[model samples]
Target: MNARSLTLRNVNKSYDGVHMAADDVSLDIKAGEFVSFLGPSGSGKTTTLMMIAGFQHPTSGEIRLGERAIDNLPPHKRNIGMVFQNYALFPHMTIADNVAFPLRMRGVSKPEKERRSREALAKVGLQGFEKRIPSELSGGQQQRVALARALVFEPDIILLDEPLGALDKALREHMQVELKRIHKDLGVTMVYVTHDQTEAMTMSDRIAVFNQGRIEQIGTPDEIYFAPKTRFVASFIGDSNIIEASALGDGRFETAVGVVEARATGAERNSRADLLLRPEMIRIADAAQPDRRPFKIDTTINYGDNLLVIGKLGTQAIRMRVPGVDARRLTGSSECHVTWRSEDIHVIA
Candidate 1:
């Protein structure tokens, strides 16, 4: 089935004269693409998703589904499928009955409803278990039933609001893969809302990082992780070491670690600056290398797959991630050299 694009123009919401939700948010979701609204609690991600689902109205804005205004449309008339955090299945009904409910509500013929229900169940790997009650299935299976129910209706768009949040870690990861495959196979426009960064990165075509009721940046996983546009984005996306510095003119800066060359795109000379360095970008070398700069190892923590190497450089404590294989050679209190490429330094003002 073909999917239609969704657009939100100047969306804003408030309660009791206080902005408790979205703020002038404008976003366009292309047809057949997967987008995620990712943020911490109270960041307005859920508020935005609810507004799109027609469960909550925007204080002021226009929501268009392929040029038709849907802001005033009721939830059922909007033709959008939704899967909630709770499975929300009918405990007394069988899986097939639950999946067929939407089609039945639409007045589909009995034969057609049965066929669609079976097909939807099969799509979610629940074909032979159609007669099982919700309580008879595991949590993951119950969630799959909910997904099958949502897809059986063949709505224009599917909105998943933390649908996998209730599952265990392993099950959650498995569901992420399954959900991605479903989206690819169906080619349906999907809007996923979650606070998990890893889930958003693994499944979305583009992620809109929300903060304080506004989108800080919207981009692919790589772009959002490596080229964050704001300090909040940098801190929120991943683990980063932000070093305070003073610009020394001509793309140079004096940092606590030492004087280092940096890319100064918008900062004025002599102004304060912040440089971001990924742990993997920093490397430790043998002190015997004559050209290597001096550094002191303070501590080492083994993390199975890798080691977190903490050291001191000119009174500045820095951390580096070393592969587990190589970490066996280094010991605490050993002197080492610390070096990083100039390109690896991300300078921010």
Candidate 2:
């Protein structure tokens, strides 16, 4: 299939013509790139995707697939593939027939439809199950059928809206791998809409984080995790330690940890801001270190491989993640010396 780039220029949508659901959203998705739209509920991620798919027309702005304008095109006229969260399969039809439904609609010959449907099923690792009905398959199998149906038509692009939301944890993880492999094989431009941060971080080549009807930041996983542009991005994507601080000039900040050094990208001289410190970035320090501060342990939660220790770092509440092997050191102790590297601190003004 030929891949096409997707672009949205100043797209805006409003239900009551007052508050915007998608406020001046503009983005350019490269051809054959895997981009995930990640955000919480009602954050405009799905609203923008629906506009791209032509399910909901934008109140303003232009949408294009390649250089052709598709702002006014209907859903069927765009020839785009879509997979929903519920599978949306025909319960009474055979699996093969269901997969071939799109081809049949386009007036394809019986032999051609059968051949394409079988190929699509094979791509999703569902070969030899064409004769089975929907009820005869498991949740994951049904999802595969939906994907085959979407791909059998060889549309310009594929869009998935929380497609793995219905599966269990193990199955969801399995499908994530399968979906990545299929994308690699076909090199199809996929726009995946998901609220799960881990899913987006694991599967996407780039991620667009949406919040409050706009994209907060768009970048690779490492950039988004380490150099977030806003406080919301820092707090929402993963475990973060947002600490209040005042810049002391020359990349130094007077924080609760006592005049810590950090990357001063967002901090200005003599200005107050917040610093983001990831839990895993901190570690236990050596005893009798004069510069080291004691982290008062108030609670500890074991996560099998790691331990989350909640404590007070000099009257400022903070959290730290340490290896499970260190849990023994904090068994009966209420305090421990802790320290972090200067480069790991990110300023969020």
Candidate 3:
């Protein structure tokens, strides 16, 4: 596949010319990079993707694929492959034909189309199923066919909009692995639009977090999860304890958790800040630790692999996740001592 970089410079989209579906959206996707546009519903992730794929026109600003401006190009003219959530395969056509549809549109010869279709199908692990119709294949297999169809033409970049959404949890997880593997093998530039945070975190090399038609942040999974710059990003990524605090200068804060300390980011004295404390960072206090907060247990939910303990540490409600081994010891207990390293606390910028 011929992978190419994608750039958007101040792209904006509005349906009624009054309300912006995508506001000043700009992104630079590197050649062969797998980037995900991730957000909650109505946050403009899909809107931005549609503009990139030429499905929706930007009211203002520009889009560039590699060195050329593609804002004026039609969807089919863009040479970008797209996979939809519904697995848009022809029901009556055999899997081989479905995979070859794009080639047929491009006027590829029969022998060449058959060979490329077979290779594409093999890349998605659907080699022998080419003779079967869509109805005869399982949801996962049908999705594979759709993926093969998209890859058969070897487009510059591929856009997938919630492609695994129709499958069950297990199948979806399995497909995530498969997609990552295929991406590694093909080295094609891919832009995946998904509302699923975990899906984006696990699959994408970089994630563009969207909210209210704007990009909140774009970074790697560790950077997004551990070092969120805004309250929205901190709260949306995963389990967190966002503590309101008053900066006390020199990286100290008066918080509900009491005198929380953090690395200085040149915070203004007396300014307000939000402290992001991940659930997994907190731990049951050691016996010798002098400073231990009294916790009142609210509930304990066991997931076999890990135990989620909801409780109150003084006035602030807190969630703590402990290893499953601790379940037997901590399950029925009303309260337990808790502590967290001050360095683990992140001050949301």
TM-score-wise, the better of 2 and 3 is 3
Residue ranges of candidate 3 with Cα displaced over 4 Å: none
Candidate with better TM-score, 1 vs 2: 2
Full-model lDDT for every candidate: 0.88, 0.92, 0.92
Q: After the best TM-score superposition of candidate 1, give how far the Cα of residue 27 lies from its true spot, in angstroms.
A: 1.1
Q: Which scores better on TM-score, 1 or 3?
A: 3
Q: Cα RMSDs of all predictions? A: 1.9, 1.2, 0.9
> Tens digits of per-residue lDDT for model 2 on 98-216?
99999988999999999999999999999999999999999999999999998999888999999999999999999999999999999889999999999999999999999989999
| Predicted model with the maximum TM-score | 3
Provide the lDDT at 171 for model 2: 98
Clashes of each: 0, 0, 0
Model 1: per-residue Cα lDDT over 1-349, one tens digit each: 5588999999998866685589889999999999999999999999999999999999999999887899999998998999999989999999899999999999999999999999999989899998889999999999999999989988889999999999999999999999999999999999999999999999999999999899888999988887788888878887777788888887788888878886546677789878888888877666665435676777888899998887777787777888888777676447777678777888754
On a 0 to 1 TM-score scale, where does candidate 3 land against the true structure?
0.98
Query: Mind giving the per-residue lDDT tens digits that candidate 3 earns over 205-269?
Result: 99999999999999999999999999999999999999999999999999887888887767798
TM-score of each: 0.94, 0.98, 0.98
Candidate 1: where are CA atoms >4 Å away? Answer: 263-266, 286-299
Order candidates by lDDT, high to low: 2, 3, 1
Evaluate model 1: give its TM-score.
Answer: 0.94
